[model samples]
Target: MSTFDYAITRTLDAPADKVWQAWTIADDYGKWASAEEVVLDVRPGGAWSSVMVLPDGTRIPLSGSYVEVVENKRLVMGMDVPGRDEPVLMNLELAADGEATKITLSQTFDTAEDRDQAEQGSNFLLDSLTAHLAA
Candidate 1:
């Protein structure tokens, strides 16, 4: 199986703990993750799921599980679409940069095509996070 990875880093206007909370809490997550609704259980082995309502009212489901978690520091998860067999791995790292938080998000996909397919959505999600932090 072919594999590919993508990584993005952003400086958030919030503290590390606050940024972490934005990711681990369902309601906070929706403010940036582009989800109309979300359900996130942040502990290891816990479920991460959400439904995103598009502009045309189409709801897309995203589901995942936390494989590893370290509060305010790092989180890793196994993520995939409902009907897809492609394995997706996501890792998020947070660090303090003065009063701001530096966030690094990395994703690995089973195939280059799979990684390419998710590029736009991944960027959009991270961009939303940055905007949320600014607000």
Candidate 2:
């Protein structure tokens, strides 16, 4: 099995702590993640789950467990994907940039096709995050 890794970095007009809250807090996550339900436990070994409503009205269930969590700094999690023997590892890092926050999101997949698709989805998600912050 080949490993395909994808990463994206973007700066948001919010502080690191605020950005962290947006990710770590269930209610805040639901607002930006297009999830009608969100359950987040932001700690190592903690579990998180959500039901994402797609544009076409498809509801996809996603669950993950945290591998590492550092307040306002980093979060690493393994996401369970259907039909996969292994979970995809996602790593997020945040840095304070004046009044803004710089976030880098990385994920490892089994194929380039998956990686490419994830990249596009991630960009859309980040855009949603930006809009959420602005609101």
- The global C-alpha lDDT for each of the candidates, from Candidate 1 onward, is 0.84, 0.92
Give the count of colliding residue pairs in each prediction. Answer: 0, 0
Expressed as tens digits, the lDDT of each residue in 1-135 for candidate 1 is: 766888888888889999998998888998777686698988998988899876678899888899999999999988876677853678889999988988888887777887787777778888888888888
Lowest-lDDT window of 10 residues in candidate 2? 81-90
lDDT of 1: 0.84
Q: For model 2, how does the per-residue alpha-carbon lDDT over 44-129 read when each residue is reduced to its tens digit? A: 99999999999999999999899999999999988998888877888889999999999999988778999999889889889999
> Candidate 1: lDDT of 94?
94
Model 2 / residue 56 / CA error / Å: 1.7
Clashing residue pairs found in predicted model 1: none
lDDT for position 66 in model 1: 93
